[model samples]
Target: MTDDTTIEIEEVGGHRVDADRLRDLLTENARIREIFADSDVAGLRVLGPQVPVRDQDGPPFTATVVDATGNVAATVRGDLDRPDAFEVASTAVVPNPTHEELRGALEVLHADERYAPFAGRDDVIVYQPMPPTSDVEQDDGTVVRRITLGIFDPDGSPVHRFVAVDLRDRLVDWDLHGVEHLDDHDCEDHLPVGVGGLPGGDTGLGQVRVRVVKGGQELWSFTVVRPRDSAPTHLGKGSGVELRQVRYRGRLVLWQAHVPILNVLYDDGVTYRDWQNSETQFQAVGSDPVGPGWRVCSGPPATILESGTDVGNFQGVAFWYDDGELQIVSEMQAGWYRYISEWRLRDDGTIQPRFGFAGTRNPRTCMRHQHHVYWRLDFDIEGAGRDIIEQRGLILPGQPVWHRIVRETKRIRSPFAREWRVLDADSGRGYRITPGAADSSADAYGVADLWFLRYRGTELDDGVGVVGGPPSATQVKLDQYLTGESIDRTDVVVWYAGHFLHDEEHPSPHQGHVVGPELRPVRW
Candidate 1:
């Protein structure tokens, strides 16, 4: 942690909460014990604490509790300053593995006799397994989660063999294809890691602060996270850089802005977008040459890039404030694919949300792929209510036209013609979104380029980021949320999906590509 970053941890109602404190609070609650009886506490998370809930004055601090066998679930939501307002839900929960939890999972395997051959090795590196090939056969494939790890051969080879460990510390015959030799353990025994808390993960909560000014007036002040604090717990691939409490020009502009749908599709039938399908490491580490050599990024960093406090573990999100536009650059390592979600907020209020794609050494390095990032922009202009989404297009060569979106629906890009804007209906203050030149349109794949829908506390990514068992990309259909909610003069969410094609004839790290949209302030 450095002075360059700002911790988003604020005291609510004179109550300071962390992961442990929240754990203690829930475990002591008589109602929780009654509802989730006879279950071991598997995990606890305080990810979304600031985002306001419906009918709430400010926001609620929410936490998820996953049971030992990963069956039962619990949720506690309360106002930040009010301790008694905590309400608990008894089921339908997913939990992110903490650093210590993953470490414990690995330690459980080491104690078993079948893994005794390499039990004493300190270099026993663990990673989320590359999803089974059978799961990739459908659009709605289920990615199997397991404690897949490799033993580092300290004498010569980096890794000689890899293995999988079930929840009971039993060894299972496993590979990229599928699992076998499980006498009792099924895929349910495979504890889901969300591909987070890998070896490079550091245990702590951190965020970077950004400030942009124009004409002697500060235009923006916000904290940047790889994915913001209240970002619906996006596993790894389905989450991107987010801006929290974004106050623009002295007014709160956005409550949160993040990408919940980040997916990479290969030419072969491989669809990667879940805990089993992604890794949250760095794209580059410790001076890996700005441009050349045997360059690649894998695993977590040796340093804690985000400053402030510690609650859980997150990796690959740091930024150094530039004299020009605030460069809130966010990079996430996803096994072979590296994603950079950058938010360039300039002094002039031009916010360019850019996403870049690079490659690492992997089986599919040369394979053609499409990287889609669906950014859910929560524009709280003036306030959450009285906000509207308008479609901008050109009537003639230079003539412009605007079409106000009234209902929740999906829209396509009209290349250089069509653009979009989200603004306060009462006032004209808003931001216009224009896709980048390199951002290709969505293909025949079952996904739209743009979507506008009414805001809801439960509408974040189909609640599939953290998984109890296997995860489903087919379940990540953002269109499922477009169930005819009115979008006129009310709280709304604008989901802009960016498409980047990795179809270069000679694609490599040297040929890195950046794609996203530029959000310029309109008539603010």
Candidate 2:
């Protein structure tokens, strides 16, 4: 006999006997002696056991047996020493099963009496089994395979049972039932995308790259660095501020640029506050913040302007509109007062930024106060270099009816109103920064309508403070950046300040009020 020709026994009673143990048992059994008496079965080697093929209606303990000479002896379908029931047979070959056939056999085991409790139930969903383990190769080049699957129910939502299959021999290794539930977080790996309880698409623009923690969100950076061949790229260092609603005195307060307003309309007949039948309704462009560290309103395309000219039934020129707006609001003292700020992106590519102090006054403290609003604008027109500031305004000479236009092209050493424009000749794009509509005391603090300075690292002020108070140290540093760097063509930033004086004696009307500045593009 060849070394490869060996005897193999199939498992019975869901358990396999050790090869040495089975050999000893067979040698001592009288029934095996009767079966192999006519054959030369001495000095035979033993091979590993094969898993038994389950019969549909046979007794549960039945299994097939083979002799030491690799010959099928007989079917063991009784409670004998398992190997004793084998009678001599002619065939010796048993083919290995495929993965699919093994999986089907395991399913049968799942429906059998062993796993009858979980055989059928509602509200129990079964996920597909994971990929099989890596193939285990034998010396003869045959492969062994195994796979495991979890059974889950809704309560506690953990997997308590598992099905393990031995695919090579086409047998169910174990149908584990009533075992201790293990936290199978790995089961979520099998879930379909967007169907599992995962966060979908709740991100904002300028947030392409961010480090997020649960519960709160922050603004890490606002600048996007795109490098030119000869110019050094601007590396974006985050502003180091929280981007979501702020906590002021234990209440959540949103900045002006963080409030989301759907639309701002100026219709022919309706007022700007009218929500119904307004001619112009602006749209938001996702959830990107309008300014640094603040959320802005975005949706629907803006209806910037509309006009038509007709000559006796023949229409002439027609104008439609497209633009954007950012509106934010903050409530103080339980809605007793609401501070609102509105910024408009004009159709002609200019920005109209403004703010207002309105709402009812608290009866407890009807003291007089004023609101000073300021804005910090960083201009990057035509690659940030060689820009000149020009102040041009119409001045009346000593009460004469005729007004003389004064135009001065120079750096702003001090703060004053002159209808300033920061122009870059190379790009031919400039911005005309001026104060918007105000109540009365817009320039009460002697600050200019606009201030210009070279771009510096830590100079930012929004001008929100007490009316008659001194400027903070930050404001003083802003002045220091303007000591006189040649702004003729270098990178620059503009600071525009506006204000509203509110006295309790002259309270705001039920409708409220608005204020700020208007910035228009010059020679773009």
Candidate 3:
């Protein structure tokens, strides 16, 4: 018989037995025989009592019993031994049952409501993203440490795998799960790019090489290093790599030269697979942060203007002398356009745009600054039952400026629930403005405006103002005027309110609300 063969045969205590050609004795064909405890058949097999009796090569496993004609009848093992031990030892000797069959049997025998647990739990599953961190040295003392981002379970257990690439050697190592084993010979050279750099530098760029392999065959390849001063190359044999700094929201990041034909940005940590790239187009997904922490907000990558033509997002705005023209852009987009009612002066003798829109008809105000000048315009609006007001102010960063009223409106909307204190931008202090009454029953409301100036080479001053003196009685507490219970990033403005007192026969107009100081932008 072969080592890997299974056949039906006789067995006594798991030993093969062959007694077919011998005698027709009842005990000879018995693969398994049993004698009950203190019973009539206890000493029937006197050779060794409970010991199994059979030929060396046993017949097919079967119980034996003597009949009147001496013909041995093959009974089941259950007929000899008790059901418990017979089932256990026989189960161990046979092939394992199918999983489905075993499960079905378990379900039939142990039918309890709470027998199978974990049937309805779902909150235990969780997914989370990995955050990048600063670099450190590896234990080998040669390779530098890098932060690898990946998903994990809520209990800090790994859910996905990530590859760690060596920036210097251009090696890719796979991190596997379960088995704590390292397989270098079992790895394949699939990619050849890595992220490397110190935190701070002039040119925020890194170096990397891309290997081109076709079906285990080597193709043409190139290596390029990006530095702030030099230009990129076609291969490792270039004049070194040059890179530019990209700053966004005061954070520095590595800038990739946009290839117009491909419209793709390539970095050391980035690969073709990471981006959706075709023959003529490509799109970048939110992958990872690399290079210097700074993001470029100007030049070829981002066209942000300061004092001439406005072209930038909300994070930052700037303008430079491309040829000889001036431009102006702001982080705050113009949301309204109206007539200016008032204007304020800065500490540098520069004029700042501060005013009210066209209600109650405030006059236009103007200011002159060292680098730029501004003019405020206000319109008059008075109807029999209501008065309308509009205001706007314009600033020319340099000499001549093209003014575009990006925003013009008569209604004010805020996302917070707090009474903002209007601060004076020039004085680096807040204004002492009297808050208006929030009377929903009377349909009374208030409005105000604020303006700011950006000095050529300085930051705005930060300060707070104190409210005191005779106006204290008319002034309402900051909490009283709030429309909601929470406030954040809300603008403080000037407000005015009024109510009529009557005895159902008489009428009188009282000074509902009074103004104190104007709201303007100061240093942050």
Q: Please give the RMSD to the true structure for each candidate, in Å.
A: 9.0, 33.4, 38.4
Q: Looking at model 2, which ten-residue stretch has the lowest summed lDDT?
A: 226-235
- Per-residue lDDT of model 1, residues 24-110, tens digit only: 667667767776666544243434333432345334555556553433456677753455567877755444344554455567656
lDDT of 1 at 478: 80
Structure candidate 1, residue pairs in collision: 13-81, 200-300, 205-310
C-alpha lDDT of residue 107 in model 2: 64
Best by TM-score: 1
**lDDT of each residue in 1-524, candidate 3, tens digit only:** 12222111111122223323112232332232332212223222111001121122122233222211111122222213223323211110111111232233233322334323322334221111111211234575322322222221223223223333233243333442221212212111111111111111233233333222333432212222222111211000111121122111122211221110000011111101000010010111111123331221233222111112122222211221122111111111110011111112222212122211110100101111000011111100110111111222243356332221112122222222112222222332322222233221111111212221111110101100111112222122222333331211112212222221212123212222111122222231
Q: Estimate each model's TM-score.
A: 0.69, 0.35, 0.15
**lDDT of every model, 2 decimals:** 0.55, 0.33, 0.20
What residue runs in model 2 are displaced by over 4 Å at the alpha carbon? Answer: 1-337, 359-365, 395-416, 439-448, 462-477, 508-512
Off by over 4 Å in 3: 1-129, 133-136, 139-143, 147-160, 176-524
Q: Which is superior by lDDT, 1 or 3?
A: 1
Worst 10 residues of 3 by lDDT: 273-282
Q: Residue 386 CA error for candidate 2 (Å)?
A: 1.8
Question: Candidate 2: what lDDT?
Answer: 0.33
